[model samples]
Target: MNFGTLYRKSAFTDNPKGGNPAGVWVGETLPSGDVMQRIAAEVGYSETAFMAPTTGYYRTVRYYSPEMEVTFCGHATIAAGIVLGETEGDGKYQLTTAAGEVSVIVQNEGGVREAALTSVEPKYTGASDVLINEVLSALGWQPSDLDGSIPPARAYAGAWHLVLAVNDQNRLAKLNYDFERLKTIMLREGLTTLQLVWRESADVFHSRNPFPVGGVVEDPATGAAAAALGGYLREAELITVPATILIRQGEAMGRPSRLTVEIPATGGIVVKGTAVPIETE
Candidate 1:
């Protein structure tokens, strides 16, 4: 199928070698859904962002994984923002996604480009004991493996994620779960991912996301989950308002990624990261 300019970018890392790779397709008009899905499957990334220019500074954006279209994707959005900056100059661009209207800011800092996205208003719900137990069993984790301080919850910014905080960093490191089992549970619960985390400090966290729904075994840096986490913390009154937290992910997978999250006293969460072009054949 014929297409417009396509760029391969690695988001959340200044270095192309260290972040999650995503395909960014910029076109005057979006292709058909089937075509987009085919291209996304061919690109074989966690997600591919398709952007089409609209009236004024606004753009219509859609995210597709290898398997299906997702409501929103953070890393791909960052990559798309950087691409838009390079093409249209750096500034805030309005994006219309399935979730809602979102704003992304792209700017060059210290000769490196970075993008920050403001998520939709966050909301969350407590995870039922039965659901939590089912997930833990699928993950082969026992009740003692959890951090009693941070209770399990289902959080949403642009998508739904199961927030599970473990007690130790070591437990977080050894991530081995039954993919099909977890996938079944996630599908049944309408979960996009399992946000597995270990709190290193008050402002620092280590995360690992199992994205069986997206046809990805693990996501290196999950922007949606990160935003959801910020919302969950605020809703639970676990962190101070106007907090800036750092999330380190994809480390164990060898593609270390960093996401900076800004949690305000109220309203949407802000997540920032950098994206660099990746050379592809």
Candidate 2:
């Protein structure tokens, strides 16, 4: 199948170089799963989004990494939203993924397109001490590096993420881990990413995501993980409802990105950010 109109966009930042780059393909019909996986590998981004119009404002969307297909991907969704807004005008779009239905709202703010996506019903589960210890061992971190304020938990928005909070920002900044070891454990535990974070303030936080399962060393901006973190905070009673928190990420990797997470009193979390086209050489 001939894939059409491939776009490269950076999510979570207005600047092309400041966020995670994702490949977006808007085709009349989506290709086979194998073909989609091949195209994603050829594009060589963290994940690529394929969209085919269904009826009205609904589209069938699938996310693929270089290695395999993911159930849901937040950054790619944001990038696809920007692309849709640029082509079809700013509006709300309903997308169907393997996980479930998602709603994305896109707006053109002074020529810069920004998008917000309402996640599926979020939930959390306690992380066993053994699992947490294994993950920490893979990361070369000691138990004392953790922040006691927020206990370890596995959070899910669209995908499952292991939430680990560090007391020091420096520990979060320096992310070097045994990729194979981490990947083995994560695959066994059915985890998508390790959401390592540090609190800068009540409403500000810094995060790093290890995504070996997707064949990436780290993700600059992870919207799905951000949503999961928000759910964890709310479910654990760590934050007040009707709050908006800012997450600063990718600075350690030099691709600085920002994601805003909005938590209501009840319901799904909203993750919002801007996306810009990446200039190719």
Candidate 3:
């Protein structure tokens, strides 16, 4: 089947150099899983989106890293939405992803086209002591490196993420870990990424995402993880519900990104970011 224009987008930032890169592919029918995997590997992005005809006006979307399929990915959604908005015209695009249905609003304003996606219902649960130990061991991080304020927990909106908070920014900046061991733990835990974070203030946070399970070293702008973290914080009463917070990621990798998470007084948490296309060869 013929495919729409494939684009690379830097999610969570207006500049090309400041966010995570994602590959967006739109088509009538998805390519073989193997082909999609190969393309994702070649792209070498943390996540690549494959969109195809579902039933009706909705599209079937799948996410892949270099190595495997993921239940969800937020950065890739924004990228794909921008591609669709440019080609199909801007408004709301309905997607049927593995995580479930999500709505994306795309708009071109002041000659800059951007997209925002609302996550599925967010949920979380506290991590067991044994699981926490296993996670810390996998990353080769000692208990002292963790902040007790935000106890370890598993959060999910579109994907599963292990949320951990570090007290120091220096700790956040120095992100060296055992990739092989972390990958094993993440796969065992059914985690898409470990959302390592440092709270800057009541409304701001600095984050680092280790995504070895997805065959990537790090994620610059992790929108799905941010949404999950927000939900977990609210649900746990760690943070006030119905608040809006900003998450900054990828600065440690020099890509610096910003993600705005709005925790509604009611239903699903909204993850907001902007995506612009990168040039073709």
Candidate 4:
């Protein structure tokens, strides 16, 4: 059972029970893919982050779900950042991931310590009609259920997500989907999660992410999806530039998580949140 320095932390919330729980393993050297996958599965979290020191202020990090290795994971990154800050010191750290280079800034604000991760260059593309129809069908939704303001698209920051905005918040709340069918379509399309959301205002939104592909029902706080949404809005010209928006998630699942997203005029998107250590026996 000995792997390395394993820490359990919840990301995107200061309370241990509010945010998404992620396993963070810090070691002198990264473990094999199979070992990492096993450890992640044993941890039984949505995603577990394995990181090892490489050089000054740089770490080699990889993410794994219970099912497979993920290209990148934002909440786990946030958890790892807090772990590093608590173990080392509060500062900036560069992470080398399969997706690309990501930088995290850890700081103490007021009485709480928080981490903000700047995602890799983000991009988005229109989703094919066939893909949209299949996904909607799997969710038992019609094309009329979608918000005309923001069209469906695949957005990527470190990982790819299918973004679908609904005009009604009720639709986002009652999230019932066919897990096997949706997982098939998502895996076929190489998607990480479905970013089902409802925009409340210009700077406020509600989101729910189905992560059947990750062997989880849903994600309480999806930093990758939130970062992707910020990028998508900026790139799609749906939101004004240099805006900071608040995303409220996980309420439906009873684990409320808040994600703060900062969108600049250009470059990578920034997602900020605080993580608290989770004590397990």
TM-score of each: 0.97, 0.98, 0.94, 0.98
For candidate 3, write residues 17-69 as lDDT tens digits.
88989998776789998988988998888999999862234788999999999
What is candidate 2's local distance difference test score?
Answer: 0.93
The TM-score that candidate 2 achieves is 0.98
CA displacement after TM-score superposition, residue 174 of candidate 2 (Å): 1.4
In terms of lDDT, the poorest run of 10 residues in model 1 is 50-59
Provide the overall lDDT of each model, using Cα atoms, as 2-decimal numbers.
Answer: 0.93, 0.93, 0.86, 0.94
Better of 2 and 3 by lDDT: 2
Error of 2 at 124 (Å): 0.4
Q: Rank all candidate structures by their TM-score, best first, as comma-separated numbers.
A: 4, 2, 1, 3
Number of backbone collisions per candidate, in order? 0, 0, 0, 0
What are the root-mean-square deviations of the candidates from the true structure over C-alphas? Answer: 1.2, 1.1, 1.9, 1.3
lDDT of 1 by residue, 11-71 (tens): 9998878888999998888999999999999999999999986224799999999988989
lDDT of 2 at 159: 94
